[model samples]
Each structure stands twice: as C-alpha cells, then as structure tokens.
Target: MVVLAVIIGLIFWVTSDDSGKNTANSTDLSGTPSYALPSAYSDPSASASGVPGVSGGSSGGGGGNAAAPGESPAPGEPGIPGGTPAGETPQPVPASGLCPDQNISVVLYTDKPAYVEGEQPIFTIAVTNAGLSECTRDVGKAMQSVTVLNLAGDRRIWASGDCAPVEGVNNQLLKPGQQVKDTIDWSGTTSTPGCETVRQPVAPGAYQAVARIGEKASAPITFNVNRPAAQ
Candidate 1:
C-alpha cells in the first residue's frame, strides 16, 4: 500500500507542471503582436542622407526639415528656427490723389491803363467757377476785398474811397460753372493837377490780387501797372 501511494503522488505532480506550461504558452500567443507594431516598421536604415522618413524620429514628433541651406520654407512653417513666419512682414498701402474733388482755380484782370488825375478809373473783376461742381454762395460771398496798390510812382491807391469795391465777404456764394462780374471804380486826386492832362502815368510796378476761399488763401495772381511818360 505504501509503494502505491508514492507512485500516485508522483503522477499528480507531473500533470500539474505540464498544465502550467500549456497556460503560459497560450497567453503569449494571445497578447499584442510585436511584428505589426510601428516601432518595428520604422526603417532604422533610413538615416543615411536624404532618406524621406529618417529626419523626424517617430510619427508623433515634429518634422525635422529645418529649411535646407538656402531653400524656402514649407507652407505654414517659419523660416528660421525661433523666428516669425513669412506672412508676418508688413504690406504697403495704396495712395489716393490730391484735391480731386475741389478742382478750384483763380484768375485776375484790369481796365484801361491811362487815367486823368482825380478821375476814378473803373476796373472789372470777374470771378468764375470752372469746376464741374457748383461753387456754393459761401465761397462767392467770401471774396473779402480786391485792392490795387501802386508799387512804383508816388501816387497811392486807397481802399477807403477811391475804389468802389464789392468784396465777397462772409455769406458770398457762387454757382457751379457760373461767373459773377464785379466793377471797381478808382477816383483819387493827384498832387499835381497838370499830371491829369498828360495822362498821369501810374508808375510801372508789381500788383497782386488774392481771393480768400474757406480758411485758406488762394495763390495770388500778379499783374503790373504801366507808368505813362512824364508830362
């Protein structure tokens, strides 16, 4: 009976060891397949020189194409390592032309050159709007006063009374493409009565007529007064 018990115990031990070995083999086969994994697929031999997928180590990491020597960078990528992208540079703005709407201009004129001493000479000044748009009453009325000054001879043209002038002061208005004519009469007595018979020549000199439009002064138009021969 003792020998038979020993033999039975030995058989049970051998069966138990074989069963554990079979369970371990089955688990290894059911687990993850190492051959199909990404690590095994990465061509470690791709690192030679210009190999496509060699630069960036793993797929999840950034691409390693740090702009080749002088070549331009890829789209959406920065030029230098730690610098700004291509689109960050500023762009130039377009220019618009000057005073396109106003199209404003000025002109000046005078009457006969010779006049009798003490006789008021009549001069005509005409203001016209050459622009396509109507010059409102405001500008037409703002023409303050037009005065003539004798730049040469002893005679002087006075604004007080010698000249009857209608200036476009505040509230003056001119219509578009319209012209308004105004007359200025100059009458002043000369020191020499004899000067009148000889056509008292207003000495040769420079004269300027300016128009005040809005708050700005229009460029002055220059003219000259001719002096008559001495009587």
Candidate 2:
C-alpha cells in the first residue's frame, strides 16, 4: 500500500510541475497585460510609414539627398564654380576697357601756324572716339608727345619727350564722338634721344609738327618759325 501511494504522489507532482511551467512560459511571452503596445510594434510596415521622412520617399520621387527650394547648392559641389564644366569657362573682366585702334581717331593740333624764334610753341593732342560704343585708353602725359620734323619729314629735330617726360596713369573712357585734348609746350630747342646731347636752339625756317600717343602718329602739319625781327 505504501509503495502504491508513493507512485501516485510522484505522478501528481510531475503533472503539477509541467502545468506551472507551461502557464508561466505562455503568459510571460503573451506580452504585458497592463500596457498596450503601438501598432508599429505588431506590424513591421507601420514602423516605416508612421514616422515622417523615414520612408524611401524623397524629391523626384526617389530616395536621395535633395536641396530644398530657394536654397543654393554648397560650393565645390558638382556644377558649381571653381569646378566649372568643360566648354563653360568663366570670362575674365579687364581692368582697363581698352578700345580697338580702328575705333579711335588721333588728330593733332597746334596753337598757331607760326611762331617767332626763341618763342615757345604749344601743341594740342586731340583724341576722339569714332566708334558707336564707349571705350578706354591711357591719355596721360606718359603716352603723349610732339615732334617737329624737317619739311622733308625724314629728320626729327625737337621733341617734347627729349626732356623729362610727364608721368601718371590717366585711363579715360571715351564715348562715341567724344573728344579729349591735352596740351604740351615746346622749348624750340633741338635734343637727342635720352637728352644725351646738349640742346641747341632750332634755326628759323618752316617746320612740320607731328603728335603721337602710344603707337599712333598724327599726319604732319605745316608750321613756320621765323626770326623775332620778322614777327
């Protein structure tokens, strides 16, 4: 009888142990009964769609970094300056807007057609813009000069540049039909290049005056220099 009772007690204990373990495992994994979980936790797709911007939807209907409207792209990016694309070179702006020579007309002028020996002669350089647009040039004393050539126009006698030259940068913009004039006085003395030779007073005779600016020379103009007694 004792053996029989021991067998029954062992079977009952095993059955109760199995039942308790099954109940604990099922209830623990079934989830918290006191707190409710979000729908995203149950449905995997809800996690992607419920949160904003997490989805693969972006500008152009695709997933990539897109600049917002009215926002400029960062520099050094593709298609930005400094990394300019081929055949799209940026044009450089010039400091001096110089005009073409064909558009500029350099006309020479003298204060008078006659002067007395030992008298100072005045020469005027008139530069006019003959083009339809505005342009620039350096008309400073550094680029201007006057020369008195023999009637033959082959020999150069006196020149404004023979002495100390005027200096400065006088860049000027000229409009169509606009004219600028500059004046220089002649000492009526002959001088060599670089003022290397002692200058001598020129002889009384008919002389030609020519004005120059940069590489442009004026047409020779006729003028006379006579002895002071004849004036």
Candidate 3:
C-alpha cells in the first residue's frame, strides 16, 4: 500500500511539470501583438498613388531644370553675335553755314583777261554779317577787319582800318544781313611781274607771278614777264 501511493504521487508530479513547460513554449512562439506594432511600417509601392515630385512622376515640363510634364518651353532671344549686317553704309555729315551760326557772307571779284607786268591790279572783297546774332557786334569798328592769306606761300596779311566794320564803313557792330566791300590794289614790279617769264631774280628759270583773291581761297591768276635780251 505505501509503494503504490508513492508511485502515484511521482506520476502526477511529472505530468504537471510537462504541461507547464508546453504552455510557456507556446506563449513564446506566438510572436509580437498587432496592437503594439507601428501602423506606418509599409513598402513604398504598397500605397495607392505616389506624391507628384517625391515618387519620380513627370515633373514640371519646362525646357530647362525640373519643369512640370504639361508645361511649354520658353522662347529664345535674338542676338547679333558675329558683326554688323551686310551692305550697310554710313552717311556723311553735310556742311552747315559759312561760319556756323554767324550770318556772315564773304565774296571776291576781280577783272579777267589780266595784263602782264602791268599797274597794280584791283579787286573787291565783300564781307557781310546778316545781323547782330550772326556777327559779334561787340567787335568795335577797330576790331572790324579783314585778313588776307597766301595759301600757296602760307603767308598772312591784315588791314583792320582799311576795310568796313560790322556797323558802317567805320562802325564795329555788323547788323543782320548788312554788307560791306573792300577794294584791294595789288601792284606788280619789274622784280615781280604777273607770270610772263621765268629765270631772273635769284633763280634763273621760267617763273610766273600769281595773284589770288579772298586770301587765296579763290583761284590764283597768273601772267608772264619776259627776260631782257642778252647784252
């Protein structure tokens, strides 16, 4: 009776231990609970549709950079990179007046069919300042003058008292469009004939004496002078 009771007690103890071990193992194998898991955990492709730019969908369609899919490209600007256009010519500037703003008029006159080695030749030169606006009236009768130049010789000669002024023949103020005349008498000597003969004074060669009007602005007039026959 005592042995049977001990055996029964041992069998009960082994079965209870095995049942406890099986229950603990099953609990461990079941894994984490769904309620405790993060709801956001998922694959990128799993979502219904991707965000526009973030998902690599067609971006802004503009020409450069990352433009949207439906957008148009910008127009190109014009340029003149190489050079000026062909067959283009620049125009020249025309001459204004005789002396810009000054309403001044200058004229020269002389006799033609000139004589050779003759008396002093006479000429007339006229200078007119249209008005005070044209002429500097401030120039007193003293300043009112004329200058004659030998263009060929590059020489200059003047006569302030000999000519008319801007005002009267003696007045300095030259009114608008007023005219004044100067008579010049240029003499010719044996030493300086018109342009007849050459070779005598200094250089023995055919030389001609020439006279010009308006300080040589006018064309020069020439005449001949014959050399004396050999002794």
Best by TM-score: 2
lDDT of each: 0.48, 0.80, 0.43
* 1 versus 2: better lDDT goes to: 2
CA deviation > 4 Å runs, candidate 1: 1-104, 139-142, 152-157, 160-175, 189-231
Tens digit of lDDT per residue, candidate 3, span 1-231? 999999999999999999999999998878756565545755566533434435554556556564458977555587767965352132221243122222444455555434344434455655556433433322233333333333343443322232322343243345566666656554432222223343222212222222222232322333333444567
lDDT (Cα, 0-100) at 142 in candidate 2 = 95
Report the lDDT tens digits of candidate 1 across residue range 1-231: 999999999999999999999999999988957674445454656663436755644456557666979899877845566664332221221132121224433444556544443345555555455454443434343343444554442344433222233454433344455666655444432223223332243444564544343433334444555455588
lDDT of 2 by residue, 71-144 (tens): 87555546646865343222222446686666667778788889888998888899877676788878899999
- Candidate 3 lDDT score at position 114: 42
Off by over 4 Å in 3: 1-103, 130-169, 190-231
Q: How many residue pairs clash in model 3?
A: 27
Per-model C-alpha RMSD: 20.6, 19.8, 19.5
